[model samples]
Target: MSKSITITNEDILQEIKLSCKTPEIVEQIVSRKVIISAAKEAGIEVETEELQKAADLFRLINKLTSAEETWAWLEKHSLSLDDFEAIVYSSVIFGKLSQHLFTDKIEPYFFENQLDYAGVVMYEVVLNDEDLAIELFYAVKEGEMSFSDVAHKYIQDTELRRKGGYLGIVRRQDLKPEISAAVFAVTPPQLLKPIVTSKGLHLIFVEEIIQPELDNKLRNQILTNLFDEWIKQQIQPVEFVKLFELGS
Candidate 1:
């Protein structure tokens, strides 16, 4: 004999909150539904062969060598054959639709935001104490101590301290607005004074700036970002309803 338990919608919401994934899971479900709808509207087609190829790739990734192994994999994931096929078909359609819609927009978007996309190499020291941050900045500026040595000595994070506070190649938009403005304003080998932010004070040392080029890698990245932005905008007006509501 076995006993079954009934869970309400509120129970599900509580579990999601405890897992710290409430809003993210909701957004993901909405995004998937919206993307699938967009794919259908765009008349994107996924043939039997394409779906089979996707299934083959999935099987290969999972090391499912035979039909029985694949079936076992599906069972493990609690998916029927039809369910797995539908999932693969939608994924293929989504990929095709994304490429179809955003492939042409990559170049212009890249050119328009070239400076923001350009990579900057910098060193940073962040301190919670403003006075200590200012003191360290002046110490480095007056040549009383080497910046690298000072950063290694004072940076709180173990990984960053070991790296001597070096923040490798990054885009302008990757940094906070205040830090970005101050750092980009100074030339290479120049250190910006302590900047106050909610996090604390920051000392910036700009090393070099790498200009953005429309290479194959960057073009692909820009296209993906544009597609994601377009998808978000498309889904913004979509209304999602709870399938199961508590009794009134």
Candidate 2:
């Protein structure tokens, strides 16, 4: 026979406390309460078809493709259909609230902060020896060797070597200050002189610089960010009591 176990509400709360998840759980509960309260205050209305579409999108996002999969997911998460609907309804409220408050501000925000979103395509090789990094940097710069040639011959990691050490599209904020200064200052298709960091010396190839575009995707991103900040402010003044700890 298969071994079985059942967890009571007391067991769940004990585990949560022991795992030091009390603050996180409490914060989430308070945040949700605050959001629902805000939605009610703002008179946000959710129609049936709109809610259905939100549920479908939620299912798609979570890969609950069919009724069987959705039910399986619900069981795995210890949630019923009613719980699922409530979750989807909250998500719908969040999206609607975000758009309602911040839709007009996205364009202005994008224009003002465009530089922060500017990105670069780069190839990098990390070397333990600063002397060797300098030599290779010069080698690539002088056209004696291509960046690929250095990556293939010098990079020890299999994946890095195969990809020619491509670092993908990186924004300035994602890089070290010194490295960012040097990388962003250089023209594309040029090799930067090696920069020393704690990990190793970096010889970077600047492939291209990508300017930020204020498209539909970026507008939505701005709206979500602005809304999240606003939510934090709204929740700050509210005092939360931990009723979960009071359960006997």
Candidate 3:
């Protein structure tokens, strides 16, 4: 005879409310629980060192230095250590689940789309004067000076100029449409001609472009995103009783 695990629907609902702040958010949260449970059932466990590593990562990501400080930061956002642990555990489970499912299947897809994953490194010269911009553009094109040198000598944007006008690895999608079009059109180690946009007259240089790879790290990230979407879809049909309505 097999023993039955007896978790009531109400118990599950209350757990969801406490973890997610709303019963309507249950399915996504519960799906993480499902992953966690699956991991445990498979005799998988997150070691203390692993949890500490995750905590360290969490702290660094939020610019904190210690677990206590991380917990304090979470409290400021109305979250608790238990909540943080659950999220970390869910992340571990999700990674394990991805390794089990799509790590092999998606590697080829990742390699095929690798070019789309390139990141840009750029230098920019921003100027308010259109005529000055045109003159500077000519100077740059004629090799009178490098973009960084000109930016340092004459660009008005102090922050960018200080870094020799470096606007570091920005995704094409994140840039303004005209700017993106201009930048992507140029191959790396090449200077783009001056572009006029709403901001100002700009000259850009492509410092480098990093091609993508089909690696374990990227595969895990893709699977995590996919699972999150899947969980959201599963939860969409669920209806819930609000706390205020329950009180009423």
Candidate 4:
């Protein structure tokens, strides 16, 4: 009952090549292939037991209780059972290779760049007009109105407005460069003046700052980030030939 589109011809491929995301997609594929190759060379092969466990976890997560349902799901995704198992096996190899290469560097990296992982809970009101932004900032500073009340009434985004413009807990690096310095510079319960970015002017109120600790999850995250950077560097020098872009 679901609609589907198949990319069986060169036309679909050509269209994808012209898209803005084509280069990024190609980079990801190339980096992954490099990782898989390195993993194989290092003899970090995924075992049958690991593959089966991964497939079982996949089925459980998707609520595919029956074999028939699992098959149907695979069919819907245009994937065979073997293809799914191969994908899972490759993922296991990649993870193991990443862990093996970077396990020792995680703690040192975490200590050096601890601020990047620290989370901040912020209340923000973004406006397109700078004049209105400054007015609102002054109003909040003068104690004429509450920031939350102003955000609820004047914030343009419906979802953010509903939450009184609360941006929730976010890593410092997750913020834009212009906003990141300002947000991280202040302590909690401080209001930032109008900060302009490409998106718009943002008036930010810091609610809380969650400091980063080298926990298991955080350590794993840092390792993954480092692995990703390594992968990017590994593929950065390779040039892709645009065969489709010729005379099209």
TM-score of each: 0.79, 0.90, 0.59, 0.81
lDDT values, one for every candidate? 0.83, 0.86, 0.71, 0.86
How much is 242 displaced in model 3, in angstroms?
2.5
**Native RMSD of candidate 4 (Å):** 4.0
User: How displaced is residue 216 in candidate 3, in Å?
Assistant: 5.0
Error of 1 at 138 (Å): 2.7
| Quality of model 2 by C-alpha lDDT | 0.86
Error of 4 at 162 (Å): 1.2
TM-score of 3: 0.59
Which scores higher on lDDT, 2 or 3?
2
Clashing pairs in 1: none
lDDT of model 1 at residue 46?
85
In order of lDDT, best first, we have: 2, 4, 1, 3
The better candidate by lDDT, 1 or 3, is 1
Model 1 vs. true fold: TM: 0.79
Question: Whose lDDT is higher: candidate 1's or candidate 4's?
Answer: 4
